[model samples]
Structure formats: C-alpha cells, structure tokens
Target: MLRFVSFTLAIVAMCNGQIAVERDPVCGTRNGFYGIEGNCDAYVECRDYRSREMQCPDGLHFDPAVAWPNYPCGYPMEVDCAGRGIAQPAQPSAECPHLYGFFPSPKATADECGYYRMCVDGVAVEMACPPGLAFNPSNARCDWPDTVSTCNAAAFLGFTCPPPPVNEIGELIEGPVNYKYEGNCFAFFSCEEGRARLLSCDAGYGFDPISGRCVDGDIIKC
Candidate 1:
C-alpha cells in the first residue's frame, strides 16, 4: 500500500532564487508521494525504492493530502499552500497571466462584462458569458454582475432589481420575480436574492412576462 509523507534531506542550496532540494532514500522503505520543504509546486515521488523529483504544472500546486492513484496536482485556488511557496516561474502571454487560468478579456469595454479568456498550457481561448452576466475572477466563473465587484451591474444589465414587497412591520418580503427585457423578446430577467440575473429562451421561444415562462415564438409577437 502507498502512503503520503514529507521527507527532507540535509543537503540544501539556494541558486538564483531557486531552491535546490535533495531527497533522502525514502522509497527504500515504502512508496509514496513526499512534499518538498518550502516548495508547494514541487514534490518527490518514491517508487520501487527509487526517488524522482516532480514539479506541478504552472498555475497548480502539489497536494500530498490526496491519496495514491489520483493526481496530486491541483489548481491553486483549491489547494492550500499554507507556508509553502511556489517555486516555478509563471509563463505569461498577452491574454494569459499564467499557463492555466481564466482571465478577463483585454479588449472588453468598461460596460462589456461578458467576455473572458480561458488559458490552458500557455494558450488562450476566448469565451463569453451568458447574457446579463459577467466574468468573476474571485471564483473564476460567470456570475451575476451585481455580485462581481469588478463589473458595474447597473450599467451592464441596464436594469435593477426592484425593492421587494414590504410586510406589516415594514420588513422586506423576499421572493423570486421575473421581468421582460424591453427590446428583446427572447431574453428576460430573473430576480433572486435582490439581484437581477439575465436569462434567455431557446431560439424558437420567447419569454412571456405575464405567464412568467418561455412560450413558442409564434404565440408571442416580439
């Protein structure tokens, strides 16, 4: 059976800001993944009494907590580096800050929050969020613009969620609400948690505000 461990060697050196690490004969006793000291992106794999140094891909970190048979490298956002630092330098491009990550498009206008780029292995691929949404860097996913601090939700959405109904004590009563986008018959807004989210219907359908559902385009003239 394989196990995870942190093995350190007495020999160490620092050359040009890179940590030169040497490992002890850990595999001589057992096979497992071993973490290097002070380096979150590097590890030592011991197998059949042989040891090999490995580095996680750019934008990823080695996670020894993961069990064997599963890749130990994971995205930086999901892995906790604790006190360990990343040793590998980043390879960036005009569109990619790192070899792998989601980034906002450089050409996007101040009011345009829908465009983004997905970087993989130093290559960038353009992507677009659904209408009425924006790219959120915090979570690296498309989310309501109102919740994205970098985006101006009111300016991009062109509408705001109305104040919820009030109760007898003047407290707000929260409930889901839907509204039509004035000029676009196929698109509409769904309000939840005081945020207005833009949604769309299928190509052959239109949003019906009265019924609060999508209907055949033939039944509702734009």
Candidate 2:
C-alpha cells in the first residue's frame, strides 16, 4: 500500500535556465498504443522555450519528479542506455502498463489468472493471490479457486500457482487492484480468507496511475 503526502505545493515552473519542466494535460506519444499513457493526466515537459529543443535521452522518459528527487518519472525498470540510437522494432517495446499504476505488460489487461503486477513507488513488482485463489475479472477481485470464467489451466500453470490482481473501472478486476472510489480516494479490493475485502485509501487521497500511488484526488484516472 504505497501512499503520498498531501500535494499542496503548486506546480511551479522550475527552470534551470537551460531546462524548465512541468506536468501538462497534453498527452505523450510513447509506445504505439495511445489515448493516455498510464494514469498520467499530464506529461512532464522540460524545454528551452526559445526552441523547445531540450529532451531526455532516447532510453529515458520525462519525469516531473512530483514526489521528489527520489522518484524519477520514467519506466520503473532499468533502461539499457547502450541500446540507444539502434533501430527499434516497429512494434512498441514491451513495457509495464503505465495506465494501471505502473503495471508491466503481459498482465496489464489482467486476464482470468489471479496474478498481476503492482507499481509500488516507481518499480513494477509481481503480486500474487492467496493459495487456492484466482482472480475473477468479472467481480474485480480475488475469488474461490476455479471461479473465474476464463482460467485456462493449460495456458497458465505458474503465473498464479498461488496468488494477486489489477484495477479498472466497470471492467472485470482480473486480479487484486487498487482503484479510485466514486471520484474520491483510493480503495483496493482483495480476497481475505476466501472473501472479498475493500480497503479504503487514506483520507484526502486518490489513485493516480501515472505515479502509481495514492495521492491527492486533484487528478483522478478512474
């Protein structure tokens, strides 16, 4: 359960004389899939107003550092700087689902399986359900063993051998997930002792997918 202190500091335009950055509502065009990357209602932009030529290296994405200098905005996983300048495959690189917190791909959509990834801080880590448990996408949380309508044993034997989930709107949960509650704070629903349990976010907080934490509801992805 990662949380952030209340965001009271205004988003001032901090400029280093060479690069000034701020979070903007303008969408970022990364990986082929578009709409909005992760829960980021705004993208970080560092530019030289005179020419807008400033940019982060190819391997790195812009980070607003809203949390502080500790959490640099970008991919949670390490980037191979050496791979820069190489012709990338036409397809988008495999990446964590920035939309849902910072979930990596292959589990972003959250299928019949009972496991997915949760972005704690800026790193994407795998979360599993309890023993004899699998997540029911239709219910939006963990459920009894073999309860999901799409649990394909042949397709998955190790992913959910025993465990967790992701969150979405009215769509199925697929796994344990943390989501915004009624346009307010964050609430994560999971299975405790074979029953569903909903955990509310701390006061004055909401789930922000871009940063992958419970922050002020000023920007709600849900």
Top candidate by lDDT: 1
Compared with the true structure, the alpha-carbon lDDT of candidate 2 equals 0.40
User: After aligning candidate 2 to the native by TM-score, how far in Å is the CA of 182 from where it should be?
Assistant: 43
Q: Local error of candidate 1 at 159, Å? A: 2.7
lDDT of 2 by residue, 1-222 (tens): 122222222223233232334433242322111111332222343222211222332223434433322333344233222323332112222333232232322452324365756544334567766533565545435565345566653243222222333346554346343332233347643343233443455777776745546777676655
Candidate 1 lDDT over 116-195, as tens digits, reads 98888879999999777798878778888988888888788888888776789998766777789999899988887778
lDDT for predicted candidate 1 compared with the true structure: 0.79
TM-score for all predictions? Answer: 0.66, 0.23
User: How many clashes in each structure?
Assistant: 0, 13
- True lDDT of residue 5, candidate 2: 27
